[model samples]
Target: MAQIDYIYSAHSAYAYLGALRLYEICKAHDVVLRHKPVLLSPVVEAAGGLPFAQRSQAHVDYFFGREIERWAEWRDLPVISCRPTFHDNPLELPNGVIITAQEAGLDADAVSFAILQAHWRDDADIADHQTLHALMEGLGLDADALLEVALSPDVQEIHRRNTEEAMEVPVFGSPTYVLDDDPFYGQDRLDMLERALSKPFAASNWSNPPVDIKAGS
Candidate 1:
């Protein structure tokens, strides 16, 4: 069976936007989806992208603001107009919860989507233990047992490793889908991703001019 490595963060807006459709695509294609949650900041930094705070107002407004609104409408996913109150809160807790579910034979995908929806739709703080517990319990999972393991060093280590591997993949942003080692970065690429399920794209012969050598220099 074909597998797609779903590398994303629990709080990523784009990931939330693409969540359900991604599940649909996987089901339609009979592809196995591996949910690999990570700390998004480090991965974004490693990819040479600016932190949210460091980004210019224009950059943030368009990409993080307007773009999100447009995509939410496009994807038919409801999202809070403003950023979540706890958007900058630490992500280890939520990311670990997803990993814990995966490791503990729980429904990690459902857990992942629930977290994403809560954060995006309801502005829930995923970093909060109570919020996580409620989210898990809502899924009919053993909240206490899951939270205990989710916060453990063993599960957090998996989250750490996920971030490391994403950096190695050099992921450009959240919601990267890796098929046969080729990365389709961002939810916007899902259509291409679906197409590739039937017809893989040609091998990459990608190249870029040396930075020191300017165009028309």
Candidate 2:
């Protein structure tokens, strides 16, 4: 079976924006979508991207703020006008839940989408046990069983491994879809991704900047 590796953070707004469309494409093409939830900060830093706090106000206002609004409208998905209330909270629990769901052979896609929607659309605190329990229960999953395993060292180790793999894959940021080892970095590239699924793109001949050249030299 052909597979597309989905590498993204649990609380990512862009992931929420592309969640449904991505699933739809997977279903249409009969593709196996593997959800690999990751730690957003380390992945961003590894890819030479600035952390949210370190970025300039203008950049933040445009990309994280206005860009998100535009994409939400484009995707026809509801999103909070501002960042979620617990947007900065630790991701271990939420990320772990998705991992656990996958490991348990459950409906991981539904589990992941529910958490992403809750964070981006409803402003739920994903880090809180009660909130996570409610989310699991809402899906008819065993909230207690999932939460207990989600916090276990084993599940956390898997989360760590997923983050490491994302770094190794050189994933730029959230919502990267890897098909045949070619990475489509953001939700904005989903159209290209869909096309590639039917007709694989030419092999990459990617190049980097000259090491000696600085920006605007």
Candidate 3:
């Protein structure tokens, strides 16, 4: 089975948009999907991308507003708001839960989708420990046990390692699917990713620009 490294973030709207479809695609193709939750703000910034809150209102309205609305409708998913009430909350707790759940042999994707739903559809706060526990229990996970591992030093270190790896790959944004070392960034590129799985696409022709000694002078 082909394996995909899903460099993900819990609070990402695009991640939520692509979650179910990715799952379906993986199932259809007999692929194994590994979810890696990380700190998104730094990853986006390191990739020379703008944080959503820092973007212009026009950009936000177009992408986060219209684009999200259209995709949600197309995907037949419910998104109560473009910007959730706790959208900007700290992600450590939620991200940690996902990592720990996967470590515990639970359905991390299901848990991840539930977290995304609670935030985007239900306007719930995932930053709260109590909320995370309730979500884990609702998913039939051992809430107390997972929480213990979720907050452990090793798991925390794994989260940090994930962030570093995301930066190393230089994943431009959330929901990036890397298959056979080829990165398909954005939910929009999912089709191309699927096609690539059938027959690998030709390598990109991008080459580093030559050093311009006098360019900075």
Candidate 4:
């Protein structure tokens, strides 16, 4: 079976946008999707890319203006026009919960997607402990128990390791998939991801194709 390593930030808008479709693609391809939640700020710093807050105005404007809208529309995913009300807050609670879920041997994809939906679709404050508990419970997960595990030092180290590993890679953004060492860097590159999955061992170091908004961005 092919291993699809999905390295992403838990609070990433792009990851939230592509979560469901990526899940479907993995299912169809019979690939094992390994979800690695990392800290985007650290990864970007290591990759020599500026954080979203520090990016040039042109980049930020393009991201908030056209890129998000076009991708959301193309993917048929619902997204808020402006940033979420709690976008500035830290995401440790929710991300820790995901790491805890993985430690508990649950399907990381289901838990991660649930957390993403809570933030992006439901507009829930993922940084809140109660919100995290509710999200886990809704997914039939043991909220109380998972919360205990979420605070474990071991689980925290896993998140740390994820971030460290991400920093070693050339990935500068979220929802980056590493299939057989090939990195596909965006949600819009799902078609290429599918092709890579279909030929797991094929030698290809493909990057994200430039999105043409008018021509199906």
Candidate 5:
């Protein structure tokens, strides 16, 4: 079986934008998707990209402005015009809880998509414990038990390992798919990802293809 390693930030708008389509692709092709939630700030810094706050105003505006609107419409995912209410806070808690769920024999895709929807669509604060508990309950999972494991040393270690792997891959942003040795960044590159995953042994190169962000929109 082929593996699709998904390296993303829980709070990334891009990840939120790409979540559903990625899920569909995995389901259709029977791909094994691994959710690796890493801190985007450090990954971007390590890859020589500026943090969100440090980036030029033009870039920030483009990201939080028309780009988001266009992609949100294209992907048909709900999103706020501005950043989400809890955008500033880290989503490690809920993300860690999802990781715990995965370790506890829960379907990772189900838990990951649920977490993303809770934040992006429902406008829920993923950093809030109660919100996470509610999400767990909604998933028919034991909220208290999962919350306990979410803070456990074992889950924390898994999260740390995910971060380390993301750093080693030199991933610069969210929604990154690493198949074999090639890295496909951005949600729009999912089509190319699907093609690659379906033919893992093929000798085609798609890493860093010329991407026209405005053309598709």
Candidate 6:
């Protein structure tokens, strides 16, 4: 079976938007989806993208605020009008997802969408254990056992490793699918990713261009 390194933050809107489609595609293609939930901050910074908080309102409106509307309608996903109540909260729930995938050996695909729904639709605070536990229980999973493993230092370390790997690779945004070292970033590129899966594309011949500079005239 072909493998993909699926990298994203657990609470990311884009990740939520593409999660189900990506999973279905992989299942259809006999592919393995190894979900690697990561710390999105350092990775975005390394890739020279602005944080959501720091971006201008117009940028957020178009890229994030509005894109959410367009994609939710297009993808038939439910979403609240406002941003997730705890969207900017610390990443324990994000790490919990990685831990769930690693220590519990559960499908991160299911857990990922659940958490995303909890935050994005139900307006729950994913940083809260109650919310996480409730979401896990909803899936008929052993919430206690999963949470125990998810909170362990070993699993946390695994998540840290994932974040470090993401930063080093410069995966700029959420929902990045890497197949054979070729990265397709964003939910918008998923169709392209599906195409690439069907038939690998020719490698790009483009190279980094020389920097242009000029002294004050």
- Predicted candidate 1 versus true structure: per-residue lDDT over 1-217, tens digit per residue: 9999999999999999998899999999999999999888889999878888998999989999999999999988899989899999998899888998998888888999999999999999999999999999999999999889887989988888999999999998999999999999999999999999999999989998666534554
Against the true structure, candidate 4 reaches a TM-score of: 0.88
**Candidate 5 lDDT for residue 10:** 73
| Residue-level lDDT tens digits of model 6 in 1-217 | 7899989887889998998899889988999888888888888988778877799988888887889999999999999998777788888655665567655677677888888877788888888888788888888888878877776777788888988888777798997899988888998998988888899999999987654535422
For residues 1-217, could you state the per-residue lDDT of candidate 4 as single tens digits? 8888899877788998898899899999898888888877878888878767787888887886578788888878887776777876786667788888877789788889888877776777888889888888888888999888776788878888888988887788998998887888988888889987665555646899877758985
Tens-place lDDT per residue, model 5, 113-177, is: 77777777777788888988888888888889988888788888888888888888888788899
lDDT of 2 at 14: 89
Query: Candidate 1, which ten residues in sequence have the lowest lDDT sum?
Result: 208-217
Off by over 4 Å in 1: 213-217
TM-score of each: 0.95, 0.96, 0.93, 0.88, 0.88, 0.93
Q: Is candidate 1 or candidate 4 better by lDDT?
A: 1
What digit string (tens of lDDT, one per residue) describes model 3 on residues 63-169? Answer: 88899898999888898855888888998889998998888778999999989888878889988889888988998888899888887898889899999999989
Prediction 1 TM-score vs. true: 0.95
TM-score of model 2 vs. true structure:
0.96
Error of 6 at 83 (Å): 1.3
**C-alpha lDDT (0 to 100) for residue 121 of candidate 1:** 95
Give per-residue CA lDDT, model 2, range 1-217, as digits (tens). Answer: 7899999989998899998999999999999999999998998889778888899999989989999999999989999999789999999999999999999999999999999999998999999999999999999999999999998999999999999998988988898999988899999999999999899999979998666535554
Off by over 4 Å in 3: 208-217
How big is the positional error of residue 43 in model 5, measured in Å on the Cα after superposition? 1.1
Q: Candidate 1, after superposition: displacement of residue 6 in Å? A: 0.7
**84 in model 5: Cα distance from truth in Å?**
1.4
Which residue pairs collide, candidate 2? Answer: none
- As for lDDT, the candidate ahead, 2 or 3, is 2
Q: Which parts of model 2 have CA positions greater than 4 angstroms off? A: 212-217
